[model samples]
Target: MKAIRIYEFGEPEVMRIVQVERPVPAPDEILVKVYAASVNPADYIIRRGGNEALKPLLKLPMGLGIDGAGIVEEVGSEVTEFKKGDRVYGVPNYLDGSYTEYLAAKATQFALMPRSLSFNEAGSLPACARMAYNGMVEKAKVQPGHRVLVHGAAGGIGSLAVQFAKAYGAYVIGTASAHNADFLKQLGADEVIDYNTQKFEHVVSDIDVVFNATPTTTVDEALRLRSVPVLNEGGIFVCTHGVWPSELFKGLLAKKKATVSMAGVDVNHHKIFTEVAKLIDLGKVKAVVNKVYPWERAAQAHHDSETKHVRGKIVLQIYQED
Candidate 1:
């Protein structure tokens, strides 16, 4: 089998397509003939060793992908939900490779591919879609009529966040560049702010919740939000990138400071991915695929995602069916 592996941490050049042994499924897992795979920010993060907590788990010359679509080649004895020849897509759990002709996945992380979508579209859903679902629905507890703001509105997670918030009936505000305003609006954002021309705080206020999808950039830009003092009292600010301990917030709470919460998403997506599949099946949501690359060009796929300007998901074709 062929797989994309990273030998060292640095630029996209570090990614290489190499020959590797085919993986076998666990008793509770399934072996899939991969049709396609999608690129996510986490793929690039793992490739560059940015997430230190995750480094110890990665084996050297590690396979670098999370989400993919495929047909079930074999199901483990312990698995009952899936069978050989079933069409599936999922986030592979603790594996040697997803960007390969054959990959293994835990049955828990997969769902039936939506009848309305192709393999490429299903490949684009697992990681980013689960991240967005956990953030918008579970953590933030976004409600209809609530005023919501999504940072990095044109990117993978942010684009889905916009759609989710809209479906839930929130008045959605999104921040992106001039080039993405129309795209953001098309995704159902009630208002799109060109972050380069105007700070989001200047144009919107009384926000009930702010979804910081681009936490890497949001920490520094937090100052830009101070100008807008109209956030609803007791409103929550969810910071996905930062870590805060209870002791760290004790003093701030004593001083009656504004509420700030640090959050981490569960990427397991075992159940959430199923729910997202339902949404796609029902036409309530869709994966936004901005670019597609051949499996051999996994390096270029990582490079494009690193740019941070990619409007939606980038997918890699692993195997083309007739």
Candidate 2:
């Protein structure tokens, strides 16, 4: 087997492909022959040594990816949900890494890949789609006829959030650059606000649910604060990046009787993946792949992801699927 490993954290150059022994499945696990894996912002963050609190916990010579799609090569004695030749896609153990020729992890971490999608597309959905599903459906509780607003609506998570909101029959509004306005609409956004030219807070109001999918930054923090006032009374605001400053935003939220929630991806939630797979197969949702790189070019893929301008997910093809 071969895998992407980092001996020490610094630049993307730190990641290297190396020959490694194949792993055997545990009693409740499955071994997948990986075809494709997606690169995420977290990958670059881990490659850059992560933050201060996360630095010491990271071991050297670590694997680099979190999600992927592939065919099942083998299954454990106790695993009955999946068998040999099952086509699956989902999160792998973060420490074990998905940027490899083979991945051995608990069967519960995966679900059937959408039959309508290709390996590259399926590989791109696990992490981002789960985050979107958690925020819009589980946290915010979006419903039919609601007016939903999604920030960073052209990016990986936001794009899926728009589709999920539409699938639930919500009227969707998205914020992105002017170039992606049409793209957002094609994804079912009823309205598209160009964040570069017009401020979302001024243009849209009475939002039933506001989903903030932008990366955390000083500017985005301020934007989150501004978004709260636009929500209708009793509306929900879900932030995937992190929670805003409660002290500053509490008064505004109280005035509107709105609630704020922080969303996190649950990698072990097989049921959520199964439900989402149904949506994908039904054409209610689709994967947004920005680019696909050969697995050996993982360093280049990380460089592109760090730029923060990619409209969707960047994937690494480990093995060509027949």
Candidate 3:
């Protein structure tokens, strides 16, 4: 099998396609032939190295993808939900390193691919979709009448968050560049605020749930969201990026009580992925793939995702859908 492995962490070029032994499934796992994989912010972050805090989440010389779509090549004896020929899409594991020709992981982290989508579209769903689901549905528990605000609403995870919140029956407000206003509207957002020309805080108020999908690790940006006055009482602030627990809420929580949650904990849970698949199948949500690249050029894929201006997800076709 072939995979993108890095001997040392640095730039995208450090990742090279190398020959590696095929992985075998565990008792509760399945082995999937990689058809397509998606590039994410985490792929580039881990490649650059030295966020030692994430060492437990990532291993050196491991594969470089978070999720993918493929046909089930083999399954473990303990797995009953999938078969050898099943068409599946899912995160190979909760941690990083899924960029490869073959991957093995617990069967619970995957679900049947939506009939309406191709391998490339299904491959784009798992990681980002699950992350969005967890943030909006699980953590925030957004309700029907709630007003939801999605920051970075044009990016991969943010786009999905907007749709999920809308599906949950909330009035979705997305903040993006003016160019993406129509794109977000098509995804069911009731309102789109252009972050460049207009301030989101001034444009919208009393949000019940604020989905912050910006991929930043700093506390600097999170501080500006002192949304005490902008959010209703008990509003939920779901931050997908790394956050310093105490610094985010110095004076913001004094007046109104709000829960500040950092997502990505159970993002790869099997049940959530299954639900995401169902949403896609019902046309309640759609995958947004901005670019597609051959798996061999994964380095370039990483470069594009790192740019952070990509409208949606970037996919890598490891094997063409035939």
Which candidate wins on lDDT? 2
lDDT of 2 by residue, 1-322 (tens): 7899999889999989999999999999999999999998778878888766567778998898989999999999999999899999988865688998998988888999999899999999988888899899988888998999999899989999999999999999999999998888999999999988998888899899999888544466687688987899999888786435566676788788988887764434687789899999898998999999998898899889988888889999998878
Off by over 4 Å in 3: 56-59, 94-96, 219-224, 247-251
* lDDT minimum window of 10 residues, candidate 1: 245-254
| Candidate 1 local lDDT, 198-243, one digit each (tens) | 9777678888777777725435344324522535666656555534
> Where does the lowest 10-residue lDDT sum fall in candidate 3?
219-228
Q: Predict model 2's lDDT versus the native.
A: 0.88
Q: Cα RMSDs of all predictions?
A: 2.8, 1.5, 1.8
- Provide the lowest-lDDT 10-residue window in model 2: 241-250
- Model 3 has an lDDT value of 0.84
Question: Could you tell me every candidate's TM-score relative to the true structure?
Answer: 0.89, 0.96, 0.94
TM for candidate 2 is 0.96
Error of 2 at 288 (Å): 1.1
| Candidate 1 overall lDDT versus native | 0.78
